[model samples]
Each structure stands twice: as structure tokens, then as C-alpha cells.
Target: MEFKDYYEVLGVSRTATADEIKKAYRRLAHKYHPDVSKERDAEERFKAVSEAYEVLHDAEKRRAYDQFGHDYRAGDEFRPPPGWQWQPHTGAHARSHRGPNPAEGFSQTDFSEFFSSLFGEGGFAGFGERAQQHARGRHSHARHGEDVTRPLEITLEEAFAGGNRALSVDNGSERRTLNVRIPAGIAPGQKIRLAGQGTPGSNGATAGDLYLEVAYRPHPLYQVDGRDLTLELPLAPWEAALGAKVEVPTLGGRVTLAVPAGAQSGQKLRLRGRGLPGKPAGDQFVRLKIVNPPADTPAARELFQKMADTLPFDPRAGLG
Candidate 1:
């Protein structure tokens, strides 16, 4: 696919900041989620917006994309042109991707790594200390510890079944592994608190609890609603019209289903106690849709012709 304009996808201007981009994505994603959208093209529109946001949300990719325009590509196949990181035409020229490129004038001291990484740590540690030396003070009494925030993505299946999740996070200095238990019926924006898992505090105070906000990735076979699992099942024309016993798949497994005689396409069937596991298991709904059989054989065409002649009802008669 040709590259989509991230700004247009989010319905914002090119000058929009990171925070503005995030706000736009949140609003659009929630509106166009496949489970809730009623527009015919909602799902396709959702995926497009998501792809655009994914690129625009990354600082590196966004920079490269803004420089290269539609030439940018994502995924593991990302390959930047030679000298792509440096350009005299860009404001970023003041500093190399490797901090300010310095000569021997540095007094034998060198600083590498990104500025954001440094500031996240002790890069600013001397700010309060140096001022304190002039004021006859040693340190500032503050919540003087790094606050840890990491995003945790969960699949819809895992989110449905409340369980323990283990995640690894690097909080500037240390790599901490956290195992958190999730509660059932948790919403997408719900946060899972972790007691005393943050950075070390001053004056021997305790650490802060790590907060995990849950979000879901798209599922290949299922869609999630609040405490429910929705799926689209393809049924043969015979199955939809002539009432047959078919196997319906659920999170638990497949079970035999009875298709009521004269069932129409797009009919929804509810399977009780087969949805996402909650206090009381929610119902699983299957939307049956009919598909035309491939006309690979003469016999198949002949059989279909016979049925077409026999059925006198017009399924779309009422639609003006």
C-alpha cells in the first residue's frame, strides 16, 4: 500500500505535537473499533488509522518519515539510507545522533547516549546539588526518585482470563522484572497497581508501586467487547438456509450448533457460558454469513441452478 499521511489519518495538522497525535489516535481508535463500529468501512478505516499512528508515534520513524515523506516503510524491514541520520539542512545537525560530536576540547571527558536517556537518570542530578552548595544546603527534600512507567500490551484472550502477567522494564538504571496479577472484567484503560515497585526513595522511604495500564491488540479470530466475545463465522448456503448441524468455535472449544431452518445470513446466535471468563462467563455470539460455493464442477452449478429456480423468495425485497 502507498504510504498514508499520518496527519490526515488522525485528522490533525502536520504541526501537531506528540501529545496531540496521541489524543487523536485514542479518539479515532475507540470510535472505529471493529466490535462497536456500524459504518461499513469502519474496520478498514481503523487499521489504516492504526498504521499511521504507529509510524507517527515513534520519534525516530516520525523524523525519518517527515524528512523522506512517503518513502518511509515500517516493520522489521526498516532500512534507512546511508547518512540518513545526518543532514546539514536539518535543525538536528547541531548534534549527531551520538550526542554533540566533540573534539579534544572536551577536556578528556566524553558523553554518549541520547540526551533523553541522560536526563532520565543523573544528568540533572547536579542541578539541585550545585545550587544547594551556594545556599549552605545539601539536597532538596523531594520525592527524589525515578517514577517508573511502562506500557504493557495484552491480547484479548489473555485480558479476558484474568491472570498474572510478567513484564520486564528498564527504568534508566536498572532492569526490573515485574509479575502482576490482573483482575477480571478489567477495561482497556484500567490500571493494575503494583505496590512498591518504583525507584529508591530519599530518607529511606519506600518505593512506589508500578502501574500497568492494559490495552489489547487485535485478535486474528475474535473481537472483544465489554465482558463478551464476538466472532464472525462463515456458513455454507445450505447451512444457513436448510438448518444443519455445524461446529461452532469458541474460546473454550468447538461445539455442535443447530442452525434453525430457514436461517438467513447475518443472523446472530448466542452460545451461553462460552465467552470470555468473568465472574459468570459471558455469552459467545456467532454471526452466521453465507458464502457462494465455488463453481468448480458441473454438478455444483447444476445443483445451484435447481435451488435458484425453486426458491421464489427475494431476500432483499424490503430494502428500498
Candidate 2:
């Protein structure tokens, strides 16, 4: 997967502060929302803008992204389908769609969920509150409870096919385990919400949501890029030059990687649909990192001498 420049997505610069980015996201998304707009590609554009906002609005996600570039989402990539689902009752979306100030620190997805909660899918919940308020404005009790965050580490295999994750958290010094169904193709720093799992509520309402921030323990030899998995495959000089079928590890399992004869070091090979799975699975990138064996033995020395005498290739011929 290619690097998604969220700053570019929201039409802002890297130097733009959180507030500026938020404003841009709202302006662009509101213009493109399908409900009010008749423009072509409005829905697609709206999803893009919302996706961008989901990253830029959060301080931690933004910082990780700025430091690592594409590597920010190395463990996961948070791409929701055109119609996204969220568990708002979990207080995971605390800052979105509350009072007048709900706009202060919300990703568009959070805001959209708030609307979705009040008005069900296809507007089934509808917009009765807004219409009824015209005759008699009621006090807005839809206060956003505090957002709860917890860190979780998953294996490379689990990261690939996301699903319901059973987890526990300490709230008021008490731990409670809950099951959270993670979406497939989730990337690191992307939050998973468990609705109605947050702080104690007033008005005898149910508890709020618990937000689980996804991360991972580094897997040996495997590095993630968006939904794609990358591996720096070490090969012997002979295998790289003479072509071989070498077994390599993928998140799914092991598969034989084809090495073309005379393939250069740092050559990249793509394994189609072998990465993180979703509606459309991502590809795996195998970068060939050639390793020359040490000439510790006479046999190794003789092999090197023979190769040096026969091979006519100049490895660094490009540098003048």
C-alpha cells in the first residue's frame, strides 16, 4: 500500500496545527457528504476526508505518523468501508456530536457515528431531535463521557486477520475483560471501541465505551506497511545469482519465493494478495538482501576466487 499523506488529504501542510487541520476536515467533508451534496464522487471524497481526519485529529496518532511517515501505521491500517460502523455507547467517540462544543476535538468518523447513533443507518433514527427543537428547544443532555484508552499488543498473525479481541482494562483500579471485534486490515494506532464500557453514567444510563488503541510486538524479520507485509529476505550469493526457490515467512504462513538468476541485491518481489486481508487483500513485499558468506574455509576461499575470475560484472559501475 502507498503512503497516505493525511496532511495532503485534508489540504493542509505538515506545519498546520491540530485546530487548522480540524477546520479543513470539516469544511471539506461537509461539502462532500452525500446527504446534502449532489456532486459526483461526493461519497468517495467524503470517506477520504473522514479517513484523513481520523488520523490527524488525534495527537498521538498524528505524532507517530509524522515521525515515521508511512511506517506510522506499520502494524495496522485503518481503512473503513464506505459505510462504517462504530460502537458509540462505549464512549470511544466521547468528543463527537454532543453539545455545541462537540466539534472541538472530533474525527469526522466519530461525528458521523454520533449521528448514526441518533439516526440509525439510512437515516432510520432520523433527525427528529433537530426538527422538534424548533418549537421548544430542549437542553442537550447528550454529553460526551470521557474517552478511555488502553494499549494492546498483538502478534503479526493476529494483526493480519483482525477479529473480536478479548481484553481487560483498569478503570478506577478495577479490571474488566471485554470482547472487542476488530475490523480486518486494522493498522497500528487505530482505536477499537467497546461500546458502553466507559465511566459511570448519570441519569441511570449505561456505561460509556472503552477505547483500545492497537499496536504490536515487533515480529522478527517482518515489517508492516499499510496492509502489506514487508520482509528483508537474506539470501546467499549463490542463490541470488543462480536462481532458487527459497521458503519465506508471510503472515499467513510460509510460501516459496522465486529468485531469478542474476537477480540483484535489493531487488523487490511482490506476492499478490498475500498480506493483510480485507475486502481487497494487500500485497507482500519481499526485498532481496544478498548476504555474502565469509571465506573462513579454504573451500569458501576457492569458490570466491573462482567467481572473481569468471564474473565480469562491476557491482558499483554507476558511481563516476
Candidate 3:
């Protein structure tokens, strides 16, 4: 059979790190997954990517593959060295003496002839037995489905208020709609899991889970840091010089904030428990930005000239 260059298939270098390989695999898997991809050759590409990851992600498999893979190019006729055979040890590759079972969901039939030649027919036969040991009295042919993770983008408001969101997912030949709950105070990079929502299992096996990683869409008025929020509040010169109560917008709603007398630009005022909700809720910080009224009209210019003459304050005195 022809040799497969797994690194080339995944578009990564031979010296790529395990994390790099995993990232590459996830990106390709998401792009080419048969349930969601629009490309005509998506199924084929997805299978190839999965097979590549299966070998590359395993340290033992990778070491063995690299030992003899240097000489052959992809698609070239290839064969294992004479007297070469696979022996299982500890870890995921451990095998039972039950021999090759074609009924297993993960087998040589699921991958290419090239893969089988490299890793043997029964290499993955023990995967289901080991991974699903908790499963009781399962059919001999049953196999759990693959888990999937995808990014879910939500608005800041939705994250703060906690609500139900409708998400549509495509299964083999149909569309499935799922209503997901958004918890209040859910932070970015947190994951929400849905059980039995991933790829369907075979022969009555339980399906895998689906994970939605949360991320926030850009908000126009606020910047988030963990659960805390920062809002730039603009104020007139008089409002800063003389204390004033101003209406400020927060995640919860508008609230009156008292600006201390002699408030300077960039001064921060904290509003306790005004950010995201939790046991100890985050606080919102309003940063003061003093704005000078424009002297576009004659009256405004006269007022500015009057202040310059009456106020004996020289701003440049400190600079010298």
C-alpha cells in the first residue's frame, strides 16, 4: 500500500509539538466535519485528518511511525520492514488475546490500508473496551461516539442576564435544534457541556458530549476584565470642579453616581456589585474623563478668556 505522510496531511511540520498537532487537528476537524462542512470532499478530508491525528497524537504511535517513515514520500508504494510486528504494552494500546474483531467500531476498515499496514489490524481493538469500561452489558459491536467542541459567541448582555439560546446543529442527514442555557455571570473561555449531543454512537452505544466554549462579541460601551467592567464616563468641567450626581450606564441599568468634588481626569469611581452577578459580584469602575466645552461661539470664547484672566493658576509652572 502507499505510505501516508501524516504531518503533510495535517499541514504541520515533523517537529511540531503535541499541542501544535492537537490545535491543527481540531481546526481541520471542525472545518471538514461531515455534518457541517460545505466542501464536496469534506468527508474524505475529515477522515484523513482524523486518521492523521490518531497516529500523531499518540506518543508511542508517533515514535514508531517516525522510526521507519523517513524514507518514503506520501502516496509511494510502501511496506513494513521484514520481521516487523506490533507488541502491545501498557497504556491505550494494550490488547487482549481475543484476536482481531471486525465488529469493533475502530478498526482497519475505518482507516486506510496504509494505516493498517503500519499499526496492525488489531491495534485499536481495545480502545472501546478501555474507554468505556463503565458501560454495562454493551453489545459486542457497540461503540461510543466522538465528542465535539465548538466556539459559541454571545453578546455581553446575554452573558450578564442569563437566558436560553437556540442553537442548530446538523446531524448525519438532518438538522437538530438545541436550546442551551446561559448562566448568569458566565465568563469568557468557560465551557457549557451538552450530554449525548455529539456524534451518534453505533449499535446502540451512548453518544458523546458536545462542548460550547463561550466568547463575547465586541461591546460598544464597556470593556470586560474577568467579571469586572470598565466604562469611560465623560463629564463637563463644572461637573468635575463641583461635585455632581450623574446618571451612569451599567450592566444592570442606569444608576446615579456621585462625582466627588475636585474630581480629576482618569479618576476611577467604583460601583459595588454593579457588574456580573455572583456570590461576591464584580464591581464596575467608571473612569472620569473631563471634557471642555468647545469655544466655537463668541459667548463661549469670552467665558474661556474670563477664566484665563481671573484664575491665577499657571498649569505650566509645575513643568518648569
**Which ranges of candidate 2 are over 4 A from the true structure?**
1-145
The lDDT for every candidate, in the order shown, is 0.59, 0.63, 0.77
What is the full ranking by TM-score, best candidate first?
Answer: 3, 2, 1
Per-model TM-score, in order, reads 0.52, 0.54, 0.57
Cα deviation at 153, candidate 2, in Å, is: 3.0
Which is the leading candidate under TM-score?
3
- Model 1, range 1-320, lDDT digits (tens) per residue? 23445666787544467898888887887777777889889866776666556556655445445543322322223333343322122244223321112122322112212212212221121222322442453344445345455567787657666677667877658887766655545667766545446676564433454566778778888877776787888888777777899888876678998989888778998998887665577788888888888978999899978878997977689996
List where candidate 1 sits over 4 angstroms from the true fold. Answer: 1-147
| Model 3 residue 134 distance off true place after TM-score fit, in angstroms | 12
lDDT of 1 at 316: 81
When sorted by lDDT, best at the front, the candidate numbers are 3, 2, 1
Q: What is the C-alpha RMSD of each candidate to the true structure, in Å?
A: 19.9, 12.1, 18.6
Q: Please, what are the lDDT tens digits per residue for candidate 3 over residues 135-166?
A: 35456778878978889999989988978889
